[model samples]
Target: MNEQLQSITGVILAGGQSRRMGRNKATLTVQQQSLLEIMLNKLRSVFQHVVLSGSQAAAYHTGLPVIDDFFPGCGPLAGIHAALKLCAGRGVFVIGCDMPLVPPELIRYICNCSNFDLVVPRVGDYLEPLCAFYHRSCLPFIEQALNQGRYKITSFFPRVRARYLTAEEISRFAPPDRAFFNINTPADWDRFCALYPDLKA
Candidate 1:
């Protein structure tokens, strides 16, 4: 583990309902590795502690701790809220399980920017909140948001100190399109397979 990441706990936001994909995306495989496994490999290389945010621990079977949302059914905000609670004031490096393309070098760079409460990547108007680092200082705002039904992942961003990695900065590690490409539907899987045709079978 990188010493700079000792205070960070890696979190995989795997609680998505997957209705659009028509199956649990986490179970989908690439080159014989489950999406969850692929996501774990990306995070485990940078942080000592890694966890999944889901309904049941056994559902993932990854052996890492799975935290169920305290504000059940809310959304990714709820998962981040619950994971932040367990960080004990440490920051959380969160990524969605559907986002199998994010690289660890980007994760390490973001985690190194610990001066802000959030370290997110932005492409003009879009923010990659799911593939960002969230500080525990965001908990109260997140709590208020969830209570008020503000379930968007970026709902609490306004209230926290945030550093957005620009498209130019993010491009150094990987192409912006592939770095953030997430598999949400069968069509999305087809697109990913097109890029890495060897992984399709």
Candidate 2:
């Protein structure tokens, strides 16, 4: 955590509707703390500043400032836009709401990656954009994509610089595939609990 705090502003994306979970995953508990609370706690240790990117006014009461997506209903891209727009620094480290096992060491490694507009890990040909870093330089491309109604998270990648983490590269920190796991459904949550026995506490 100390290593990651050197230079980064963590942005926790929690604006999703959580339809699959049938409840607000952000408020779900893991050891008594809400998922959002746990995420913010972990991020605060690594980032110089932390901001919650979402529209939930109730979250503002948590004492951290909240930033909403400039354009709503566009999925993760909206969260990315909000982070980019409200970040006090030039670069922002983004993390999703449901990824409780995100390793801080891995996050630090990605943040330290210099000279990249975006730094993302690839999980079997799929890019994990939700858990990555973005530079202010990507703002124009994001704006263009949003205006054009092309809100896919990776739509702006072709127009900007991006560093992808191969399976081998990520394996140093976690199992090539397990590293990107998260809870999206009750079944997944149950499996995660079984795998990470401590989560049930």
> By how many angstroms RMSD does model 1 differ from the true structure?
2.0
Cα deviation in Å at residue 77, candidate 2?
A: 0.6
Summarize candidate 2's per-residue lDDT along 135-173 as a digit string, tens digits: 888888998899899989898898888999888878788
Best by lDDT: 1
TM-score of each: 0.95, 0.91
User: Candidate 1, which ten residues in sequence have the lowest lDDT sum?
Assistant: 192-201
Global fold similarity of model 2 (TM-score): 0.91
For residues 1-201, write the lDDT of model 1, one tens digit per residue. 556699899999888889999999898988888888888888888888999896844577788888989999888899999999876547799899888878788899999997798999998899999999988888899999998989998877888898999999999988888889989999999999889656321
Backbone clash numbers for all candidates listed: 0, 0
In model 2, the Cα lDDT at residue 185 comes to 89
Where is model 2 poorest over a 10-residue stretch in terms of lDDT? 1-10
Give stretches of model 1 more than 4 Å off.
Answer: 198-201
In model 2, pairs of residues that clash are none
Residue 158, candidate 2: alpha-carbon lDDT: 86
